[model samples]
Target: MRGLLILAVAVIPAVAQNPVVHLTNATHPASREFQVGDRFEILITGAANQSISVRTTMRGRTDWGPIIGWTNTSGRWSTSGQFEKGDFGDWSEVWTVGGKVANPALHFSVGAPCLKGGQGFAASTGVNLVISCETADGRQTFGTASDSEPFRTPDGRVVRGRVRSNMTADQYHAEILQYLITSRASDVRSGRHGDEAGDLIMKMIGPNALNEDETRNVLSIIRAAFERPEPIPQTARDPSRTLLLLRNLADSADRESVKQQIVETVAYVLAR
Candidate 1:
């Protein structure tokens, strides 16, 4: 009997299409000027069953630079990597593929990095996006893209440029406190203080006990507002509401000095 001839067929899987990556400032799609808090988006298509990685670098510099303040907002896409501090003390984020998801869209907010003196970006820093993907066929593809226009922090002039590298920690802390105070004051003047105002105040104080100088500065601002007469536009000055919030914080304060200062400020407001 003739030996039976058997033929084996090898089936090959289809290769995945190369992914397209797009990075844009969703908050201001047409403009390159980004404020302290603005949203940035990364859209990835044709990435089914492929692994992807996203990295960032400054436009001209090869070394990684700070990623502004990157806070992820989208739940659709997930990442295993996190913001890593570089050797130069700058920060950058690497988003590694967590799972195989199709057409992932990522959204994040970019705020000014906390500088030595709470200063903003000194120059118009252009952050470039780099993406790499491994296809199902084991082929690697890489792409580098950036925003349509270079990002410029127009408010840098208002907040002042970046702090000097030689600034002391104490000076940095003081600058942060001053910035917070000035911001809150602006909110009050613009009638932007809302019900969540107290939450913001507490965030400014943080969990640690404030130093004597910090405590004094906070009280001084409260006193100045408390003593001011009702403005022509009543909405312009809501000292009572602000004081009520501070009073609540005072009641929960852990430090005697902080509590005392807040209480004294509240009392002054109540007395008026």
Candidate 2:
């Protein structure tokens, strides 16, 4: 039966020496209470690597069906593996991401083969386990793991909860967004003697001080950022506050274009 796909996992923490994440299941197929159509939810924590794997075994040949369904952000992640009802019916799949540098995510999963199996022709609905991990250099990531316990598709419905689900979509969005912005600026961390250099970059298009070339570079960066599918009309009145604070670091011969670009870009973004 397709309901045979129920799986639960838990990762235990390591003791002494190097840090490690333990993974196992408390209630597995061995549980007498387990049912074919029974769905559960599980969660894992602190997973790294921008990529995580998941799988399940099929019961038999005639009992299996084709593993099918498409991911929403599929093509962007450089992911691997495939969905198939294997020879014995072990349907497995994996998702690789665009590294933590991209602020990758998993919004929702619909029409998975497993859902149709156990529940007959009906679809199994729930919030798929979403995890984010870090790069080798420690870049922030998202969607790298899943529930450490058994969470049926129904048990793991979307639209998060409080307490265990206190963190809402808005909060998660802010977290991922900040992680991305920080990653982009990490290379320039040392350039800032104080906060002045940062400020100057923020007001890149501003008049007085920054030469034409400097403004142009800053404008290019700003324009490029706007080109992305970013949320229009950002709430950040002055994202360059950090840039302004770093303005003092501007070099003696720094081109003026950069400064003008900074101001102009800020105006353009705020205007939208």
Candidate 3:
């Protein structure tokens, strides 16, 4: 199958300064800028000169949620973030990283509340730069802070997260789904994309992919994408469209259990 992820990195616009962050690799020419969805590496040139924050801020949790914080240890520093599905069918995370570093600081941000996940990093002088992501909700972190691991549904038609660090916005995910559905709905409609998205899914999902793995990643991405700063108001018009999309993926992939779960979720959301 074909996947858009294989496409080369696209160009990005310049990030504003101050409270705004510029996440980039030192190798790129300064003349060019990264767009909100252009993927780039964060390189620390000076000890205290480097800091990155999420363009969006997440609320601190009273008992749970992404309470992300990090400390600098010896010259070695590491920061890790994990997100999992909650009892109420929400994605929540608890993030912490500690290490000594020249700068001794890590910047983290979120698009919504701690409900989805956390984003941050640490810098140590020379220690290994360890960035770990895990989920108790049974989802797999794709090995970076970028996106969820890729996998296929039981039917053999591959599917995975359409969102990544570069496109760290709900609108991005929504647009991507809309594009895929609009393009394929005629043949597959709310179903699966044959080659394009499939090929991209292979690269991300990899060989170790499992059925549960794919389910967790897909739902987490969608829920995270649709999540609001506050709990989705139980309103009739609050993005009830996703119910069909989510259920379609599940049914098309033959995930009966997940499809039923989504149907119930749709009822709850619509009832609100």
Regions of candidate 3 where Cα sits further than 4 Å from its true position: 1-212, 220-237
Candidate 2 error regions (>4 Å):
1-16, 29-119, 122-176, 179-272
Ranking by TM-score: 1, 3, 2
Which candidate ranks first by TM-score, i.e. highest?
Answer: 1
Give the per-residue lDDT of model 1 (tens digit) for 115-191: 23332222322443322233333333222223222322211111123345766654454344445443444322212
Clash tally for model 2: 68
Ten residues in sequence with the least summed lDDT for candidate 3? 55-64
Worst 10 residues of 1 by lDDT: 79-88
**lDDT, each prediction:** 0.36, 0.28, 0.29
With a 3 Å backbone cut-off (N, CA, C), the pairs that clash in candidate 1 are none
Off by over 4 Å in 1: 1-80, 84-216, 230-232, 236-238
Better of 1 and 3 by lDDT: 1
Q: TM-score of model 2 relative to the true fold?
A: 0.19
Residue 131 shift from truth in candidate 2, angstroms: 21
- Candidate 3 TM-score over all chains jointly: 0.22
